[model samples]
Target: MASFEINGGKRLQGELVPQGAKNEALQVLCAVLMTPEKVTISNLPDIIDVNKLINLLQAMGVKIEKVERGTFIFQAKDIDLDYLQTEDFKNRASSLRGSIMIVGPLLARYGKGFMPKPGGDKIGRRRLDTHFEGFAKLGAKFNFDQQAYFYSVTAEKLKGTYIHLDEASVTGTANVLMAAVLAEGKTTIYNAACEPYLQQLCKMLNKMGAKISGISSNMLTIEGVSELGGCFHRVLPDMIEIGSFIGLAAMTQSEITIKDVSYENLGIIPQTFQRLGIDMELRGDDLFIPSQESYQVDTFIDGSILTIADAPWPGFTPDLLSIVLVTATQAMGSVLIHQKMFESRLFFVDKLIDMGAQIILCDPHRATVIGLDRKHSLKGIQMTSPDIRAGVSLLIAALSAEGKSVIHNIEQIDRGYQDIDLRLNNLGADIRRM
Candidate 1:
């Protein structure tokens, strides 16, 4: 029920440290179920989703000990699979999409798993067909009844085979990877999702004695081993947060520095933002965005209006499409924003339009934004958050608006960004969490 009150039109000038990646942390936490030995994770983001996952793991009898604020030591020594059948587990598990990932690890380790429908950003039909399909290929049997998904694999020794995913679904690939790590034979996954999150998952699994190649590529070859041992790994910095900060700095004309960013991992982020005429200087592992009067939206090489779209990894992330769309509203030129991954994501543009942004929501998947070029600033208004990315988009818009803006459903934002209000406040943004 909390809201953010932002006094906008102020230049944010300071250094901001990015937190650990939320998406990566979710997978890493689920990976703990792969082993009964203690696994220590450092640099974990203290976000709501991570906390929820940790609580869920603990409820399942995983020994979760906080080593520090952003570090934790976990051991799923005595997993209670029966917990998945309770209403508490169902309610919490259904609140986040990452909960679906537990199915594979639980089945691999415990030989059985059950979970109710998982929940996440209601942008599109996030199907579990890919996940179920991948598991079936790995000698797993599944049943769906009474609004719950039940999966079991009777094969004492799981033998791996080639798996061509129906789609390059991120969680689907991850589930298959988790299951294949301990199978009897080798597993080859083609058309896999090689996003940074998945890459980190592969790295962590390899560290634990699972043989995996093609870390950042679509085709992954996993040589299933007898068992995985415990290992310590640090979660990667939140790239989505880094992208969000970039958009925030651009929209507010802020001079900000993002610290401890892995520059090499940022594949197409810089180039994607460059299309909006926003440039940043790379200082070692940090990114410095200086305050600017206005940004220009570049046109296509043929002098046509530019279009920014999202794709799988090596392409622009769909998660950041909302950020790019919101940032474009403050730029000088016009551009088309295409969100191919989700249908309802662009529907939130109506909120931006109400804030004086010249946006045409062409459909559920596309929007055309004409930048105000600092000649006009968005006036503050009360709005509701639709999802995690869209909620952060509203926060950026609120931060750049001329007056106070109230954004409800702060839980949506909390699910992703960690201490967002506090972090932005450090950069001199006049925002209060109410």
Candidate 2:
């Protein structure tokens, strides 16, 4: 029920460090359950979602030590099987989508896994078909209790097989991959997600003695081993956070530097922002963005209005589309933002429209933004954040608006971004948490 009270029209300036990948932390944390030895993970995002998953793991009898800030050591040798059937475990598991990942490692190691319906942002329908379908292909028996809304999968011993996923769902890929790592024989997965988070997951699994190839491609080959050992793995910087910062700088006309971004992994994000007329320079490990009074959107080579849309990987990520959409409201041109994965994500455009930004919501998934070109700045308004990504988008708009803006229901924002209000305040943003 907390709110962000922001005085707008303030430019942010400073070097802000990006937090560790939230998506990667979820996948890596679950992958730790594949081994019984000590596994140390560093640069873990201290966000609400991650902490909830960690607490769930601790409740399940996994030995976890908070070695230091943003670091944890995990040993899953003493998992309590009885706890998995408890009401507390079910309630906690239903609260986190990351809990679905535990099904894979548990099934692989102990031949059984059960979970309640996983919950997360209600942007759209996020189905668990890919995870269960992949498991069934590997000889697991899948059953669902409609009355309890519970799902369970069991196997005597998994036998690897080829699987062609219906979609390259990120969490689905991670879950299936974890299950296949300890199964017998070889497993080939076509159309698997190859995002940086998945790349890190594969590398970590390999370090733990799993045979996996095709690191950056949609096709992955895994040779199942009998067991896995512990390994130390560090998550890459959050690209979503970097994108949000760049959008914030552009909309507020601020000079900001994002440090240690691991540029090699941010494949096409920078160039995508460039299309929105953002000027960014990658200096070693830092991305420097200078203040600008006005930035114009780029047209296509054919002189047509540019369209920004989300795709699988190496394409514009759907996670950052909200930032891009909000940033477009201040640019000097018109751009169509299409969010393909989630239907309801684009509904937040109504809030921006209320703030005096000219926008057209074409459908549940498309928004056409007519930039003000800085002819007049947006007027601050009161709004409630719909989700994690939309919350930050509103915050960005509030920083660039004329008056003051109040954002309620910020718990959604806290689920992903790590202390975002404090971090932005450090960079001179006039934001107060109330």
Candidate 3:
């Protein structure tokens, strides 16, 4: 297990260019399997999860060539379908949560797909029902192996139909959309996840000859094409990372400029932080967060306590809630962070509380953080990272805390953020990776 040794209580100053979207990269990389032609994708993040998915594709016989850093050309001309039955394939597929997405393209082009129970962050119960259920709606026969925890979908031909999702799941919507693009006739998906990354997928697919309408809306209509062709696509900057950098700047009292953020796509993220009383200046495409001694949480118009909750698109993202909770530690007022999607996401408050933040773990879904308002500084302590978001949140806390802090299991952090320590160190943060 890798660990990060951080020396805290120093203000940082520099610019950070956010990496390409991790969530978007996962979806589009899997989409390469739907076509035999070459697809050139740029701005790919060099993170563990993204790299894992890329490697998984390569193992399945997709010819991949590196054009340069953050760019690749993929051709699925000769995919070895027999490899799907191997134990090596099962083990590799089961380890990555994103691997479940490959089933969509495989089932679309090859008439069958199989995946073991996919693995990812243990934030809560991330069910695969949405994916398989959507597949079943598209005329695919679905089966599950109880003993092996395996899932399989097969069909001679898929016929698209109307699908109203149980939940607006991003991955679920992506999986179903990929399958429906090659199905016979039209597919209308209501209540689809309209996240920017999902929209990026739709745009990419449209460019590749898939007739997809409603690019930025929940109701997506896809007119199935006989086959999809190759198209060049570039991923947007990761909004979650941009949000993290904003919080980090405020918490550590750093003047950091996040460049080429694709500001318009970051729905509600900037305003959500501003509601926390963090001052930011939007200079063209860059977000400049100046150093602050103390920031304040805003109250409702009726003077009630501010509640920051996560919802579907156009609402604040749940991924950055952990960052928000940690940033509020030194703010001027209290804010309630309601993590609606995942139950265990708020469980990381114990680590922050140990670091001297006044946080109340109301339950599994919510946390009330009472800002110290800079009257007190968090004292450093050794801790372990539970998940990706929590790990980065803890790292941010450590950077703003007093003395030294040791964080174990930094692989969780590496899975999402690319070269986090080195990037922050360039901006004057004292973090040693071991």
lDDT of 2 by residue, 1-434 (tens): 99999999998899999999999999999998898999999999999999999999999988999989899999999899889999999999999988999999999999999999999898999999999999999899999999999999999999999999999999999999999999999999999999999999999999999999998999999999999999999999999999999999999999999999999999889998899999999899999999988889999999999999999998889999999999999999999999999999999889999999999999998999999988879999999999999999999999999999999999999999998988888888888899
Which 10-residue span in candidate 1 carries the lowest summed lDDT? 146-155
Query: Candidate order by TM-score, highest to lowest?
Result: 3, 2, 1
The most accurate candidate by lDDT is: 3
Error of 2 at 239 (Å): 0.3
Model 1 residue 253 distance off true place after TM-score fit, in angstroms: 1.0
Of the two candidates 1 and 2, the one with more favorable TM-score, higher being better, is: 2
lDDT of 1 at 218: 98
Ranking by lDDT: 3, 2, 1
**TM-score of candidate 2 on Cα atoms, chains taken together:** 0.99
lDDT of 1 by residue, 242-316 (tens): 999999999998999999989888889988998899989999999999888888999988999999999989899
Which of candidates 1 and 2 reaches a greater lDDT?
2
Question: Candidate 3 — what's its lDDT?
Answer: 0.95
